[model samples]
Target: MTDPAYQRLGLPVTASPFAVLRAAVRALHPDTRAVRGFRAARKRFYRQMLCAHAARQAAGDRLTG
Candidate 1:
């Protein structure tokens, strides 16, 4: 069976947790990384996603990633 989280993130099933997060940050575009607002938003978004995913995993729920 495939990992739902990785699949939803468009990452390989073997991807590490960090890789999944990096992908999320990348999704918002790297060019905006130097912008303070975008940088803060990206960090918040990544943190939220990571926490949510981990919570779902702990609950035995299959995340859509």
Candidate 2:
């Protein structure tokens, strides 16, 4: 099944995860290092939440404001 969290972020889970992440990062116009750092940070945060709680709890936080 596709990851609902990614879908909520407007990402297609059907595509390769890295590709989706790279595209999203590029859309932000971040430098290569910044993109890598952001991805690393996201991975760490999600890992901690998943280990301590659940994937649902670590859901994507989308701000529309």
Candidate number of the best lDDT: 1
Total residue pair clashes for candidate 2: 0
Q: Worst lDDT window (10 residues) for model 1? A: 1-10
Q: Please give the range of 10 consecutive residues that has the lowest summed lDDT in model 2.
A: 56-65
TM-score of each: 0.55, 0.27
Could you tell me the lDDT of residue 38 within candidate 2? 77
Model 2: residues with Cα > 4 Å off, grouped in runs: 1-10, 31-65
Residues 1-65, candidate 1, lDDT per residue (tens digit)?
A: 33454346675444567876887766665577767867777777777667655654655545443
The TM-score that candidate 2 achieves is 0.27
